[model samples]
Target chain A: MTDNATRDIEELIGMMARLPGLGPRSARRAVLHLIKKRALLMMPLAEAMQQVAATARECLACGNIGTSDICDICSSEKRATGEICVVEDVADLWAMERGASFRGRYHVLGGTLSALDAIGPEELRIPKLLDRVRAEGVTEVILALNATVDGQTTAHYIAEQLEGTGVSVTSLAQGVPIGGELDYLDDGTITAALKARKRF
Target chain B: MTDNATRDIEELIGMMARLPGLGPRSARRAVLHLIKKRALLMMPLAEAMQQVAATARECLACGNIGTSDICDICSSEKRATGEICVVEDVADLWAMERGASFRGRYHVLGGTLSALDAIGPEELRIPKLLDRVRAEGVTEVILALNATVDGQTTAHYIAEQLEGTGVSVTSLAQGVPIGGELDYLDDGTITAALKARKRF
Candidate 1:
């Protein structure tokens, strides 16, 4: 008789392979691992996954995921930094959090303005960002957009839109970073280079 | 007013840092990316995480994670190879699965027998494996233990226990792996060296 266990495991492997960075080989490995550590790692992981699924939702205002309409950051009274750091995606937001330095609220742009793809400001929540800036009396808007062509185009457009709003526009520093050597720095970097410029 | 957003983000960052292979720096970067892509990647990932946390459960028999008591693998009759490839943990089992050649049942030993650690046969699934062999009419037992000292000891002990049980035991073949060279072979490998190795 055909083995049902094999089919079932194969299905699980297929699902796991769909995850980012995991292929069929990795998925199979992961599944086997979970089975072996059922009591310690797998069981707990399953429980946690279930709990999160039941309670997680997107924050309506900022699009952050949490268990409520407003995530902890949005609901907290202390987070009103009077400035919003705007970015294109959640991955970028995660990167910023890794830095652990910023002290401001955020505005996730969802995606860049792509004319060819028909993605515009309306699709990217630009209107919502403008509303937050006006309502919150934000004095600065950090354009933490990617260094891609599309990202720059979107940034310049947003800057133009916010020009007369009395808010200062800024970005992450340019040039070789900490632990970066000057010889490795590219020609394009030298052009956008920020002088050892002063205080924010 | 104090910046509540920063504090909340920082707390989130702390939690993210505890994930496997991610440090504080990567966690910060991840958080920033999430903030930027809040509407797309971050929100969806959060939702998916929550859903999985709530629904994940371990298979009662095989320890595979699923929504029900018995994992799909254990319940499937097709996987009854009457051959259980024994492993030390789930991760190891997964690694074998990634190879995708074997099509037999599995028995996770959980851990190896260790005299120093006060671990005995009872601590592992040795008795359970014996019972399974009798119950399931298993013919071959593959000792897929690790190459570690404890792993070898456990394999030998299991072999002794199964003496006269009429089951053939086979260990994984060792040699220069696919695309591996004889010069890269370690001492153990050079010793286990077969006079006439089979060509795959």
Candidate 2:
């Protein structure tokens, strides 16, 4: 390749490398794969990206991303169960949807409170969530945040914010994960699981 | 977001998941990241992919991909060294270029011979490589093929074909990789490195 062509391809690879779960090496591999399957994969991917780029937007109600002002979960009448699942980001919300257990709605916080990063409740959708609780007559708020310290701190802050909102607040149980081996369980997880053991 | 909007986003995510090194989970995260940085990252990526899709083509001379009929490496005077590195795919050629060591041109074979898959010498650029060796006055043909069974078989076949062509055929050495820990070394790699031990 000439310098110009090589540079173009390299720039593409560099952008791809910035994506989550991909490194420079894997990005290069992906570019090659795209090139090899240009007709079948690359062209379609480019068109899809263009379409999404032109259409994708955040849900005004819940902060979930879609091709409209309101996300599917937020707009669906079937999900109007007066329950809101709070998550740190859209990825967590998508994970919850994949589980197919949550029949209500979701609120994507964008990120959690981080003292080092100077992030606060105001930086997230906390205020919007409170408004939704009152306006939508939400009866429950499920905190599905990660088990990290910052995640818990954000959950506690949100719970405190909703103290006088007349809504039930619950968090996911901390215990041995399904399919987890006892040998690989951490001390904290093992302790939590033991303490929360059921009558079974 | 209605069903139509959800379908659009889901379609994009499905296309992304088909790319190499990206699973359904990583694709979801990547889509979210792209949506988050739509103006800065996603739009440029979409444009770049579109440009590459429109203009990228294979070089008629050495089979390397470029925007022109002849690839940059093939047309460059500086890279006109008598050595011609042979690789099974464009990705290997790109990898060699990234190392910034090889100054010669390359011949991409597209793929190796796989009898089970019914692939033969005619399926690759073996004939064109021989023609280039004579036409371009190539002195050395470096076989940078993968170390798979099919790759080695293809290498040996190419070497045998070039026996009387006055071209030196060579393959990459098999041994321990740089920065690789001995504890993590596989048995085959350890044996090969021991057999090919050289003066330190």
Tell me the tens digit of each residue's lDDT in model 1 across B1-200.
12445445566656545444446776566555555555555545544443444455555565445567766556678778877898887667767877988888778787999999999999988898888787888999999999899999999999998889998888887666787788888878866767436686
Model 2 TM-score is 0.91
Tens-digit per-residue lDDT, A1-200, candidate 1? 12444445555556545544456766666555544444555445444433444455556777655666777666776778787898887567656766878778778788899999999999997999889888888999999999999999999999999999999988777766788766888877765565555576
Compared with the true structure, all predictions reach lDDT values of 0.71, 0.89
Clashing pairs in 2: A2-B72, A70-B1
Docking class of 1: incorrect
Q: What 10-residue stretch in candidate 1 chain A is worst by lDDT? A: A45-54
